[model samples]
Target: MPLTKGRLLLAALIACALSSCQTADKPPQPRFTSTSKDAGSATTTKVATSRYFIEFRSRYALSYGHTYVVFGKLDKNGNMISPEVAGLAPASHDPSQYVVGHFIPVPASTGWTDGDLEEQYRSASWRVLLSEAEYRDVVAFIRKQQAVSKTWEATVNNCNAWTGEIARHMGYKTPGIWLRPQQFITQLRQMNTTG
Candidate 1:
């Protein structure tokens, strides 16, 4: 059949319009589906409504027989931010031997210059040794607490009334300890620049 240019153009437009209309009127399709028979089956999954902050601890050894713990942060303020824990030990080598416990503050003037083994031992007042397994447990504890404190307000819901409570609850001591505000902020800045 012979067709005019106008007729062909009109047919094309009509077909396009009909296809778009059909698509627009169709029902919405689900993106995900469960194969399980039970609605509450173990395989069935639901998206979590809440999220948590996270901290990481890399393994490190101390001068003495103790494992050093260094704190790190993974999530904060709806962003995935990983920051190292400054001025702390990461893991101990011989935790059992260092019964005095771990924690020896190095003087800024000293500049980490404990040259001799004897000198380092003398300077290290506390004797706390941590095995690799114990150190892992501590790191896990820190991560768990970080997850719990999603918001500053929720953290303040506790008595400490501070954003660092999550870190503290995991085993933070006094000034300049793990996850202190100044130290954490410093580490965060370092991480940002390094990346």
Candidate 2:
């Protein structure tokens, strides 16, 4: 017997349903399972990833017998920001626009002269792994520090003080006063042992 239009349409619908009529947007879900020790039962959970690591550098070397200048003896903010000496400074070098933005040419003399090392300084680096929420908190803490350090002075609020603030914000202990560069780096390493 010949089939009616309704019967033909029903047959097509059934065929499509059994074939590949499912929407592509909703593919499949991934599951992770764990078994219990006592009850012999299992549990499935969805795995997620939302953690990352950020590295902050705290570097310094022994110099002038006083404190390591975090970078080099002459790589302070004043010198780096305004390195305008003839040979020691980079003619009209703005340290922020130096070779790598952070690296300021090591001055020739202890003060400022014509022919400095023009090389980068040595430092210690610390890496911290944090969650998304933690990253935001840490960055905000750093910004606050930068704002406060805008009026930093060599005699009082020096480079060591600046790095110390950042380290302290990240849950590390810093010295109260007159912190040396190498010593501060040592403290950072000790605290970031797990990270």
Candidate 3:
């Protein structure tokens, strides 16, 4: 028997669920970049300092997608070292929790959920270098957020919101959280880069 429209849709959803958080496409190159400037001394000499960085990233996923942050200290050669990841998502791996989240809130898990390390799935990213003080503050704030954030809802509170909080903490303007992960990350980069 030929499959009906409803059957096809069901099959698609099931396939998406099974393949969620997995992708085959190569990771997109970093599309946005920002740097922090150090002030010169009264003697007209500039001091060198180590730079840390926070990267707001988006990746492909089952539904609209996912957004998260990767942050760490940068080496003298400007490479990330021991990057840390954080994001919010349904606590349960069961697909039902994600489905229920669309209509109501579900328990959330913050910090290093799946799809974080798979570079191929990354859709967008914004990297901002920070001062030592700023890096400490941002890391502390992320830890506090992870401790307090308890729930997830698709429309009200989700991955975008999680990253938005971090962006705001870093003094960057944020876009609407309702956008797809890729769009949200792009807008966030554009907004801060221009102003």
Best prediction by TM-score: 3
Regarding lDDT, does 1 or 3 come out ahead?
3
Each model's lDDT = 0.27, 0.35, 0.77
Task: List residue ranges in candidate 2 displaced over 4 A.
Answer: 1-51, 60-120, 191-195
- Residue-level lDDT of model 1, residues 41-118, one tens digit each, is 221123222122222111112421211223222232322234223222212334442222222211111001122122
Cα displacement (Å) at residue 10, model 2: 99
Ranking by lDDT: 3, 2, 1
Which of candidates 2 and 3 reaches a greater lDDT? 3
Global fold similarity of model 3 (TM-score): 0.77
In the range 1-195, model 3's lDDT, one tens digit per residue, is 356987887676556444533434335645455664411111111222456878899888766678999998877766677889999999999999998887578999988877886887888887777788888999999999999999998767889988999988877789988777887887888777753
For each candidate in turn, give its C-alpha RMSD to the true structure in angstroms: 27.9, 28.0, 8.0
Instruction: Give me the displacement of residue 169 in model 1, in angstroms.
Output: 4.9
* Consecutive 10-residue window with the lowest summed lDDT within model 3: 38-47
How do all models score by TM-score? 0.21, 0.40, 0.77
Query: Sorted by TM-score, highest first, which candidate order results?
Result: 3, 2, 1
Worst 10 residues of 1 by lDDT: 105-114
lDDT of 1 at 54: 27
